[model samples]
Target: MFTLDQTLARDCAVVGDLPLCRLLLMNDSQYPWLILVPRQDGLREICQLDDDQQAKLMNESNLVSHILLQEFGAEKLNVAALGNMVPQLHLHHIARYAGDPAWPKPVWGALPPKPYSADALEERLARLQRSLAAVGSPLSFPA
Candidate 1:
């Protein structure tokens, strides 16, 4: 069976589940970010997904990027599936602005992760859930 890495589990809050991916809201409030983790067991690479699954992940990623851009007015959308740090098969969709912290650079190691305050976290989570719902894919944080 596949298990989420401890670091990922600790750093990200569950946002919702889709047909092919489990959407996670990273704790970092610096960027509007989401992580998509496929539910395949013991998989750690994109190639691990079957052809149909690959297509689903891609389509879902695109849909997510579109939502982030339209809702947040992002200057740039960064999507990546790097597993160097966390060896689980997951993709990151980040909304970046030209003037955001660590602009023109990768978000990794740019600054310490600033966790959301309770109120801020709740508000952001609600907004994201509502947005996802509008896209016909409502999600929920893990209780």
Candidate 2:
């Protein structure tokens, strides 16, 4: 069965879920990012999904991409499912801009991840949860 890596489990906050994927918010304030993890256990590849589930995951990913673009004014959206380090099945959705801290470069390993201050974290989580709700996402997160 697929279980989240302990590091990821501790770092990400549950944001919401589509039919086939669970959405999570990465805790780093360095980037506005999300992770989508398919619910099917032990899935390690896109081909592991049945055709319908595959379609659902794609649809949900696209929907999230759109929201991040429109609401967050993201100049670019980086979508990836690389499992080199963390072997669990998860997709990353990172909102990027031309002037962001690591602009023109990938967010990964650009700099040390900055953990949010308590108040900052609370504010960001609330903003993100509200935005997701406005987009018809039914998920609410604890602060």
For all candidates, the clash counts are 0, 0
lDDT of 1 by residue, 1-143 (tens): 44667888899887777778888889999999999999776788999899999999998898889888998899999899999988889999999999999999999999999999989888887888888898787454444
Write model 2 residue lDDT over 1-143, tens digit each, in one string. 44566767788877756667777878888788889888767777888888998898898889779878987898899999998878778899999988889989888889888887878777776777777777786563323
Screening candidate 2 with a backbone cut-off below 3 angstroms (N, C-alpha, C), the clashing residue pairs are none
Q: What lDDT score belongs to each candidate, Candidate 1 first?
A: 0.87, 0.80
Top lDDT prediction, candidate number: 1
lDDT of 1 at 29: 92
Per-candidate TM-scores read: 0.93, 0.87
